[model samples]
Target: MPTYPAFRIHQDAQGHHAGIEQLPRPTPAAGEVLIRVGWSGVNYKDALAGTGRGKILRTFPLVGGADAAGVVEQSAHPCYQNGEAVVVTGWGLTHDHDGGFAGYLCCPAEWLVPIPDGLDPRRAGIFGTAGLTAALAVHRMLVNGQEPGLGPILVTGASGGVGAMAVAILARLGFSVSAVSGKPELTDWLRHLGAAEVLPREALAGATRPLEKARWGGAVDNVGGELLAQITRTIAPGGNIAAIGLVGGHELHTTVMPFILRGASLLGCNSVDIPYPLRRTLWNHLASDWQPPDLEALVSETVALEGLPPVFEDMLAGRTHGRVLVAL
Candidate 1:
């Protein structure tokens, strides 16, 4: 019904760029609803998409956030009502569709999950996709029979959004968490997130053997490549490794020794294309028991819609930590 500010990312004849611009209000389609976005969370992928780093955008001139929380502005769907709070993540919001880096977002009702009673919009935005992936990793680990009694659980990239949340959730669920980070300065920060110990990047990178001594019961690895390959080798018998991100590198140089001898399982986590029902369940857990105790501390910054460029640079350069929220 009205025009609003939106941050659109695009690649043109000039080059790739993104900026805040005025956009017409979106109209809800059949089985869809429109949300007046209150808060949107920034992820590494979002940063990449915003800055046109990895061709993250399937189509250009799109809003540049994947996760958002807000109140329903209008609805033609049975599952949602006007003025109701909702959270949206995954379902290809930022890549193929208009995303939350706007004052409003219109999407299928199926993509919207009612913001749980206990959580506020800011809290939901803080957790966002990062918390969802953490929950997925934990859920997969549990389904694979990961147990605290087995040994310590390892979380790689433990100062990042998903890794930090994973450490907190796993530690809360009675597992002893050993977190690894390249930034030795974040050791205390990781400890505050419930890590029993913080290991330097060197500790996780020195495994020359195809199969090293078993140390962790399981691992939630957000950095792929060498770190994931190393985790695959050192996991205890029957341990599962949830390999999530490919920030370090995408290639894995490892033999099948860990899988055959140790029976370690390598599970790939896809937060973007998960089924809607399961995604809703993860959101519920994020609002309940899996919610991070120090969520506020994990939020490194909150920027306005117009202040996204420098944020993107910081993330791509690996200078950012924790979650960054965008107030819409």
Candidate 2:
């Protein structure tokens, strides 16, 4: 039997552990495809799961990556054929299912999206989960009436992967983006990614009133604790908040005044398990008009499977920013 290397994670009696291991290569079953994965990327969720710091995987001993783009090596599904390029993110990846941290991935065809025109495997991997989530947030906000004229779009946790992507995409769509990040040294980099202003985390200070002065027209919030609460209190009337992460804290303590009174909408961006139709739409937009001006600038690191542990450690420690591409 042929074998391939994979970054597999486990939580047996010995305790949580993960590392690359040789595993028997799988053949595609009916309604499935075997992809020769060319690229994958690390997200905050990957760091959490790899470090065992968060309860991300319900079942253990699975390959550990959330995003992948590659060419189909074999197909038992009608929608795809051998040599067709494909991309996969979210849908059962890195949870119960083995994910993209391997040389090959055999999965149900439904989970794969044909790599839209204008993007090859490497470029799609750069977008990965972070870019998709950012697109989804923007999509929801737009459907709910978000517009550049509303006010500046405040992207909290602006140095992180999703926040950085949101900043670039929003700027491309002509929104004045204000980025809030704890890393001062990355201020210039964030501005280059198209933020009109790079504010420190404390810039949102004193927004504790039941309703403070409305500043942001809308927001893409990655830090979900007090910062998100602060955004809720200050977003303009009818602004939408796309809540994406909880690295700061999961619990949201705020009043309904932001919703009922101001008509503020808190949109939850669950990149994982997003419906297939919407997923395809978002990918098309990402490849086309909504494409960022500089995808290379959003990437801070690129590493192979062997380098993932250190990258995960640095990412969890807040030593890195933007996207981390995993070249297979």
Candidate 3:
């Protein structure tokens, strides 16, 4: 059997361990596609699972990756054929099933989306789950009545991958974006990416009470602890808050005063397992109207399969920013 490189994670009496190893290439079963994965992206969830810092995987001894962009090498489904470019994110990758950290990804054909006309596999990998989640957040907010005229949009944790993507996408859509990031070193970079202003981590600290002066039109919250609670109080009346990510904390403790008195809406964005139709629509937008002016600007670093371990450590330690691409 031909073998290929994979980032395999294992847990036993020795605890969590992950590194590159070789695995046999698999043939596609019914309704499945085998992809020659060209590129993949690292995410916070990937870091958590790789490092055993969070409960992300249902089982161990599995390949670990959340996003992949590649070309089909074999297909057992009618929708895909050999040499077709595709992307897959969020679904079962790195959760229960073996993921895209290998030289090949054998997944259900339904999990694959044809790469849009404007994007190649590398560019698609840059978007990955981060861009998808950001797109979903914007979609939910727009459907709930978010607009440039409402107020400035606030993007919490703006230096991270999803936050940066949200800032660029929101700016491209003509909304004045106020990015909240603790990394002051990237303030100019954030401004270049279309943030009208960059605020420090302490900016929202004043919103400690049940309610504060409503300053934001809406918010894309990537940090889901007290910051989410604070956003509930500060969002404008009739505004929508797209809640995504739980890096800060998962538990939510907030009164219903904002919803009852201000008509504020908190929309949950689950990028994982989104319906296929909406997934196609979001990718189309990312390729065109909602596409960022500089997709290349979001790339923080690029590494091969052997280089993923240190990247995961940096990501979990809050030292990494923007998108990290893994070239297979």
Give per-residue lDDT, candidate 3, residue 232: 91
By lDDT rank, best first, the candidates go: 2, 3, 1
Candidate 2 per-residue C-alpha lDDT over 101-141 given as tens digits, one digit per residue, 9 for 90 to 100: 99999999999999999889999999999999999999999
lDDT of each: 0.90, 0.94, 0.94
The positional error of residue 8 in candidate 2, measured at the CA in angstroms, is 0.7
Write the residue-wise lDDT of candidate 3 on 1-328 in tens digits.
9999999988889998888899999999999999999999999999988888878899988999999899999999999999999999989999999888989999999999999999999999999999999999999999888988989999999999999999999999999999999999999999989999999989898687777899999999999998899899898998999999787799987889999999999999999989999999999999999999899999989999888889989998889999999999
lDDT of 1: 0.90
- In candidate 2, which residue ranges exceed 4 Å CA deviation? none
Candidate with more favorable, higher TM-score: 1 or 2:
2
Ten-residue segment with the worst summed lDDT in candidate 2?
Answer: 201-210
Estimate candidate 1's RMSD in Å. Answer: 1.0
In candidate 1, residue 32 scores what lDDT? 91
